[model samples]
Target chain A: MKNALFVLHNSADTRSSEFATLAAIATSIGNAGYSSDLLILDTTGSSSVNVKHGSAFRNVTAVAPDKAVGDGADYLVHIVGKAASAAVSLVVGFGTISNRNWAPQVAASFSAEFVTACELIEVADNALRVTGPVMGAMVQKTLSLGDRNAVVLYSGENLAAPEGTDIVVEVSREPAEQGAVRFVASEALPDSGGIPLRGASKVISGGLGIGSGEKWRLIEEFAAKVNAAVGASRAAVEMGWVPSSRQVGFSGQKVSPDVYVAVGISGAVHHLAGIGGAKKIVAINKDPEASIFKIADVGIVGDYEQIVAAAMRKL
Target chain B: MDIVVLIKKVPDPNLPEQFVSISDAQDEVVLHASSQYSINLYDLNAVEAAIGLKESAGATVTVVTADDASADQYLRRALAMGADNAIRVELDDKSRRDSFKTAQALVSALKQKSIPSLVIAGRQSSDEDAGYVPYLVAHGLGIPALAPIVSIKSASERTINVGKLADASIDEYELTLPAMLLVSNEINKPRTPGLKGVMAAKKATIEVVASEPGGVAGVPSKYSPKKGQRAIEATKFIEGSDEDKAAALLAALDK
Candidate 1:
């Protein structure tokens, strides 16, 4: 059985939800056919209190006992507070500066044993799946391997199987697959709370040639008009016009919104990965060639900015 | 002191006309590297930061990339921009892999040289967006780690003062010698390599290799959106005068 090392921002007593999320995530890992070990760091005061074995954290694969350096499994994860923590040699930083992602903490604590690897899959700008048949992709994905512990991404609404999968389907933002995944097993946590999406909507959606950040004002105007929220294509966000929070793509937010509108947005599969299953999709790109038009029951092929203005006028 | 800065070659996260099926079909990738925004932004900045540090502290800077032959071009730019050397960790594997093992291989390489006092890296790479390497190296090396450092003040041979751009406030810390820092856009402004540097970067030598055994991370699944069905009715843009337009917009959205 593979092991997951979870790192936490504070001890369980402090960040209860984080612990809960870890348990739930651990449960998901178990469901996916993997085991987990948790690590929690309590920087409540100057004195660093490290809990180890089963005493401080029950079932933790390997918790840091008195600022112990590295001794963990294959996967290290940091949870709660974007700060990076290490129980093992593996290091990871996620979630918000305050509410970190659940997996990195575990990965960090188990850094030593777990050899982490990274892969780039083929997916649309808005979605995170590599192109290929689902079955073949599933087989390829399953057949393919990474170092002992690795973080992988895919698009669609499935985790490939009912059990025995050691991957996670995180619906949050995915930045460059570079040094952004921070880890620190030795000392002070990798204080990394560069949350490009906090306080913003849980999921944002945008579309089409949001070519320039200034032009994004048009999309933002529409988003403001609807108050529904904003998400963008790999196109607009790349143009550097919109906030990464508002980006929607295979590499961005996977949103399940109360309301979603595909304004001036094309429904590319990559883009679809980020906005698939929106309650309501309203496409308004000018290009009838825009794929979003196909997915949009409410397709409008005209100048998006003008149409948005018109729509705004009507609203 | 020698500083090793690691960068990644990733696809631009932004593709204008993208489709999920695009990733599904190999023949369908819309764009290539240098086209992706974040990879260039972060990678370039990493190179520039290395140069800046070398200039400020009288250190030699080397850049390493776990990328392909094509990225040799990107790394060469680093050398042109004043990086002493560029090492490319080329892998034969084309199948999707994870970041952990790649970093492991990189750490091994860095160890051959003097262990860097401070390793600088981008906060995250654009292609994978997994965001977890610099921390792993720091952990593996058993050193202190600082990320998102926006400001820095070298205090002495033993300690360095830095500022962390926290969510709400500025968090300051005095880092002791030999620490690893994961930089975000928050750090010092990263400069662009000049045409001269870019031309020079093209000729640098990089190393590539066969990746070791990485296991199946798992087949990722798609997410199901919970949004309701959109109206099948014809979409009519609410319109009127400027005031009417604003009113209509507000009325339609009811925000």
Candidate 2:
């Protein structure tokens, strides 16, 4: 029988989407005839007896963090928690296996520690493969682990379970630890009137082709109308047309939105790298040969000023 | 204060078309003759951060890498960009390094010398895109680490205040000395090597250290395209006037 171990984060809110998704994934693996084992990494050092009984999975088992290492399994799926510190600890815990033959998959927020663990595991064991910072939708569509010995998939925050999947697992606790670095206090900076771009479902970005800082209103108008976050390319940021916080590129935020709209963006490889996880990319550039069009699902070779305005009017 | 920055040499990812698939499994990519290799983009930012610190706070910046002699070229570039010294951790052909192994090698090398008060590295290497070495190094050294940092707000003799960008918000941290910071590209603009700096780099000596064998080497790569993967082709092009194309794009966005 196939054995799959689901390593979930012991979240504070049992009804959180993160927990529900993990439960669904565990249930799906069990239904697939794989003898699934659930190991919830408790960062808060909470008791697991209550958690195991309260979980939706039948015969749920809580594996201690220390003992969780080197648990022989055909598959290891890490459901990333919100706390980067907890995720890092869990990743380091499981990553201690020098040469374990287990396909590990992680779904997380693409934290530095988690990504490093995935890289280290892949480098340490050829048999183990890691895929993700995978989105929840992708996980739902491709949940089958099949016969892989070791797979690592990283699911991000706020994931929903697949259709018809029941999410009935809840555990009460505080949020996991942030990391080794201590947080001093939250400083409120001057408002830039920009939304967080990392996890936004839809993003409307402008590039260097937009020309001037004043011209960014075109992007702002488009974003406002579409109810999407505003993003800028590295060039645009460099040119001072937008804040560096709003830049979406390798040097900036890595985003994987459902719909990424690029206006006058030439689609530099650096820009494309940040958007690799984007589901559907729409490019609007006058240059047909622009690299952005190569990856764009739909291409529109035109002037952004006219096209975007026209598109705004239609919307 | 003494600072050490971790850097890497990676094939210019911008030239993806020039990447040759060597294995039938399509697991490996070799650079074409025309393709050039450069310092990992984020590492360059780390180097810039270190140099900026060195200039502002009076510190010596030493750059380290766990790569072969061929990396000297990039190391020289670091020197030109303002690093005081460079070290190359030599490895045997069979000795492959995952992030842990790489960190182990760097740690071993660092142990042979005076441990720096501050360690800096890119958030992640562009090629591996793992972003693990900094944390692993910090963990191995039993030091504190902060990552995805936007800027070093203030630096004193024993403490440094910095900004960290989370998914939705920016958080601040005041880390003591002897900490590791993995910087993002937003930290600072990396300066290009000027003529004088380039000339100075040519004369700079790169210190070489050999890494012990069996330092956690097994996985061949962090990323491998599944078999039968091809370049994406744009399925539809809204061909018409601006109004028609805009309308089509809007329609597609709705779908």
Candidate 3:
């Protein structure tokens, strides 16, 4: 049976390694007949997880991770841990773009850390709930691998220390992953700038002022016409169109794409940190005078839907 | 209830200045300031939380460190903030990277004092960022532990509420008493020792027993921000009423 090792990275914000996430993933893999083991790499090796809840943390032993060369487990699912590169076992987050750029680089990291779970539980098929775009993509990728597949479940922001050709999940699937497919990226992908912003052209973006979640489609539609990637302002994200990882500016990704389109995005100083380097900016807003116009190379003064429609026609 | 606040001093990893000369010469980064952020913040929060509990329900606060005479100012500061007393456990600074040795020393010292009802500390000292000591301390004490706790409340004398972060959500668990906790920014804003408390602390003479120095040093490479002209402006926002004005402003911003 293939085995999986889950590592919990220590975060100042988290209480215990979200054992529930581990337990759920463990159950899924176990039902598939692969044994899984959980490893809690206490970055702060001193803290405890209250493993049994209000109980002692005697559960953790000095069981060092198996050496990389000897790692025979099929998949290693690292939830939380910090490693600098894809060569390292999976940390809970994504590594640099260089790692995610290739599936094999990320897959190898997980292969290095796979360990079978000692106390495995049977999980119902219902537990394989797909989360953000990356997670959905990862789950789909792993399922496609069938039995004996090693997998790593990480957040969009966390760096990945993959083990091997193990399945890696991300909301925004890269066009290069030979086997993976994008199921919900056009939707969930924008929640995060799953792909690099600097490499993008004809960029599509939104802001908090977009109002409701339903309004997010406006930016998406504009993007669809221009064949552009979607981007968002902090204000738009605060409204919940996207996740924190997708936020652009000082708080989010730093991108320098060509032909940046800001739809209903008021130019907030905080949003400029990442977008400051964009080559060309186009602003569209119903308000004849939104802050986004200040940075626009081309400003359209009218209803965004009308301008966007007119632009799409030209494309 | 007896509460112990575990604090540590290590090389400030963020400050690039100290790392430069040390890296080239000694090949290791050294601890600079004694009143480091992690330890100080954790220590004060632990002390304050303990004091609040004591005043509210009567828990005793004890501040201990694996530091030496050099930590006088910081220890004094902790005391001034109303830590009942302080203890110093020394260690030989050999690898300086092996804080486990320093933790061993402190744990040994604490075992002699009483198994505290609550143990709290910063997630990790800023210098080492090797957030291991608290867990080891908990392991040594043979009790449940929680790290990176943001909010805390006494569920009972032997139980406390801990707010911890998880990948998807925050986990709020009621921890059994006499457990260890790693304090984070979420736990509570640490209180600064006020001027009045400083005066009173001056009158306090802490007993210092010799052991060894904390044995955790590191190689901190200096980080000089690639030097450039620094701008003093805060944040800028685009504001306009008409499309022309807004467009003009946007053009200016792109520049």
Name the top DockQ candidate. Answer: 2
Error of 2 at B242 (Å): 3.2
Model-by-model DockQ, in order: 0.14, 0.38, 0.01
Could you give me the TM-score of model 1 versus the true structure? 0.59
Q: For residues A59-105, could you state the per-residue lDDT of candidate 3 as single tens digits? A: 22212222220110111112121222333222222211111112222
> Model 1: what is its DockQ?
0.14
Overall lDDT per candidate, in order of appearance:
0.47, 0.61, 0.46
Docking class of 3: incorrect
Number of clashes in every candidate structure? 115, 22, 65
Winner on TM-score (1 vs 3): 1
- Candidate 1, which segments miss by more than 4 Å at Cα? A1-208, A218-228, A307-315, B10-41, B55-59, B67-71, B89-100, B144-177, B183-192, B198-255
Interface RMSD of each: 10.0, 10.0, 16.5
Q: Is candidate 1 or candidate 3 better by lDDT?
A: 1
Grade the docking of candidate 2.
acceptable
Which lDDT tens digits does candidate 2 get at residues A24-118? Answer: 55444444454444555453445643443224454344433422221211112222222222222222222212101111113222222233222
